[model samples]
Target: MTSSIGVAVIGAGMAGKAHAAAFRAASTVYSPVLPEIRLVAIGDVYAPLGQEAAKRFGFERHESDWKAIAAADDIDVVSVVVANSLHREIVEGLLAAGKHVLCEKPLSDTIEDARAMADAAREAEARGTVARIGFSYLRAPGIAFMRQLIDDGRIGDVFHFSAHYWTDYGCRPDVPISWRYQGPAGSGALGDVGSHLSYIAEHLCGGVQEVSGGRFHTSITERPKPIGQVVGHSRGNVSTEMSPVTNDDYATFNAKFERCVGSIEVSRVAAGHPNSLSIEVFGSKGAARWSQTNPSQVEVMLHDELGDLAGYRTVPLGPAHPHYAGGWAMDAPGVGIGQNDLFVHQARAFLEEVAGLPEAESLPRCKSFDDGVHNMEFLAAVAESAAQGGATVQVPANAAGTTNTVGTNTQEVAR
Candidate 1:
């Protein structure tokens, strides 16, 4: 009904800036044109950070309080990028105000809060508002293309999925403690990055049925207490005082899907590797592997290849890929894309759905709140298994008694 949608991003930290920049770029990508997106404001409790983000990202203004954003009539959509413990309060308030929301990942600090937020989303949906979770890595062209191939039976009956996400952000023992290091056991690296792995594993394969062989380790047992606010992974000012880390710095687990098994490893204390995530899926017919280090290509082996030529071939993403045709600036092979571009694609998708465009006219719909809840359940299962000393644990069934599958919208894939 509206010709233009007003947007605001709360929490002007690292991910918050990404959301703001994404909205600024959303309208420029893809065809069939999205409704005008107004960069209304940037909200963050830290006035300086919010003001800086607003100016840099072209927002009209900055607000120090998130409640002001919820009450503003000009804003129609908001991206909640605050701390996990703050998600329920901020999201529920925005939903009550009839604003569509795209929340950052892991849903909430706990499954209980995630479920409550989902209930709020359901109520808000009845009023024509939307709520979605941000799983930006899923927008990677190679990852999306891999899902398409599996769906089309390119790799028949996936038997094994192996994935590992490693980052050196917390490798130093001197890194100050922030919310990232403060949570229940299994919350550190597992909840931070492992959430992405769990969702991606399910997206390519199927819903996870159970998990076992869960292990968690904290290499840096304690860190200096930050004297002031810490942003993202940055270690701002810190006192000589130290605080005990209550979560794991490293976690590994095994998952059982409907028809396949998976292994996941994640760590924030990894050295040398900075933001390295790789996945290899083996199927009855062949295998495929992709890595974040090489985001623009996938290496695949298929049964169709003859004996002498049978091996993995590199497939560079191009106009022929799932989201590359009109989703990027160059829109051509080897032109390449990166992590920030994924945020652009994700932003465009969220705006399309918020515009109420038909399925045929929109990009893939963002993952629903129910899907977010299912993701939380998967994380909880892994945590439970870790607590039980690597004993097998069943993933809780969805309230709808159905597998949680992300909508690929392969119809958008160019042949």
Candidate 2:
């Protein structure tokens, strides 16, 4: 049923121009219409930033070689926004050239190259082809309506989770080094933004079965060698030639989640936090909070019988939440949403699962490459619990079940 597909994007930098403007705004967002996507090609080993992100994302062509969009047989979908040590050789050569990939999180830069790119995305998903892991902040509609109010119990048995993902773009030490200050010790800022706060604290509480105090520091221990490339979080011209950051401009940890208990924090030298991700959950009856510096509201508190008039209220997100109705264009409540509309709802749920659709017409699929090798084995058990000083490690069970999609279908909410 591939009537038309072809998309492409291999790092035109800055989240590769938000996955090339989210595949040119994924079939103009939502509804059962995908297939003719074809913006096709923007690859970049820097050919003028892949010809200025293929003339600013309309993408008809520009490929200074990501193996020419992985040996183009008309690229049937690809994203892999480069460098986490080139995500296991450009996502195992674009899933052995069968395409359908998303990639761009801490899925590599080691955990043995994210378990060999999740075993080449399970042999390119047994030939039907599909790989994922952009974790576009879980396509935020206030974190998908706070994971649908903690899977419909409205945050009732969670028992505590906290988070932080601060950023100031490496708070000035002349922000330069690049390859994000050269990886390896929980690959800086805890594998860059604590790998989205360890998959949004295990996508709202579940499977992080252990980790502990784990800390890492770095605080600009050396950075100043750009003079060229260095795109996203741009400082772009440095060369007093310093380079010796080797990882962690602050990271914190503590998790154990088969049923909740987490705390995670991250920083890129956070001084005034130019990009903050905050979360809070604590249930038995209620508590919720969200914050990508307020990406369309969620604050909640609910513990019935408000005697002295309760607390934490905010809610705002409209079209009955969870990806806001028709996925927004003024889909109601307060009319504002950002982070590039969560990469256009993660490129319309990876082009509705590469256009095979029917998972009740898709929106919640995109998280697996065995959940990016279980988020690089929970960031290698928080860099092996900060190299043994903070102790308590455990984390490696990964039977690949953090539930990206199973039941309670979503993606049809225009009411």
Best of the candidates, TM-score: 1
TM-scores for the candidates? 0.97, 0.34
Question: What pairs collide in candidate 1?
Answer: none
Compute the lDDT of residue 330 as modeled in candidate 2.
Answer: 62
Please give, for residues 42-117, the per-residue lDDT of candidate 1 as tens digits.
9999998899999999999999989999999999999999999999999999999999999999899998999999
Looking at model 2, the pairs that clash are 188-248
Question: In lDDT terms, which candidate is top?
Answer: 1
Query: Tens-digit lDDT track for model 2 on 249-323?
Result: 888988888777878888887889889888988888888888988788889888883869788889888877776
Off by over 4 Å in 1: 400-407, 410-415
